[model samples]
Target: MTPKHVQINKQIKLHFALLFVSCILATYLSGPSLSSMPLLQWLLTGLFFAGISVLPLLFFIPTVMAPNARNLSWLGFFLLAYLVWGVVKIFSPNGLIGGLLVCTFILTTFFYTVIWLRPLKKAAKARQQLEQD
Candidate 1:
């Protein structure tokens, strides 16, 4: 795989892992307060993060690992939406656990933004010229 593809793959994996961890952390931290509706609360927390992180990921995976992958700049906008949410959470009053959860969300969104901005075509062109020698 090309270097750009490698970077994108790594970023996706990292972001997904972080999102999952954030979901679990959120569920745990809010569990007690949600004791009456434990199942629903946890499920919704997980689903919300999954929807923001994994759902858009579907559009990225097919081309993320391909050398000639077309640029999906549009995906970055979707990710930015999550970033905004994270920022809002960070600023909002919350306890220690809530702070950590927001941090994780921020990290995931930052990495995704980096992935989306990768100079794929430029790198591909450079690689192609080098290979033709």
Candidate 2:
């Protein structure tokens, strides 16, 4: 890869990390954290909600930390559930803001992930053609 590609990859990874953090924040926002609850209850509720939503994504930590085309593609596919959840939950009476935020974060992550993978995919295809030739 050229220096330009290396630099772009670093930037893409940084943006993707930021998107992931924002998505997690959206999830936490969806829970009862904003309600007028006591300190302990609020803490537990926030933690449980965040934990359940984030636990599955934790499996992709390796992929996020060191991205490759295949793993990044898989991660994109995995995020579809979050996307759908956001869209569906938007209609709920109490979750409007949180749902909108979730939709925003998930869509940003998905599209950015695709952008990040495009160059890597082209490079992989080039290598495959070289091997065949």
Per lDDT, the best of the predicted structures is: 2
Model 2 spans > 4 angstroms off: 3-16, 33-36, 123-133
Question: How well is each residue in 1-133 modelled by candidate 1, as lDDT tens digits?
Answer: 5676567667766665566566456534533455556688767865676456445446655444442333445445555665565566556554256546755755665565565555665777889999998
lDDT of 2: 0.72
Candidates in order, TM-scores: namely: 0.50, 0.73
Best by TM-score: 2
* True-structure RMSD, every candidate: 6.0, 3.1
Model 2 C-alpha lDDT per residue in residues 1-133, reported as the tens digit of each score: 6676566567656655655565566555665645588888877777777677677777887877777788888989988877787777677655677678777767776776787778778978999999999
lDDT of 1: 0.56
Off by over 4 Å in 1: 27-72, 95-100, 103-109, 112-117, 121-133
What's the C-alpha lDDT at position 52 in model 1? 60
Tell me how far the alpha carbon of residue 53 in candidate 2 is from the true structure, in angstroms, after superposition.
Answer: 0.7
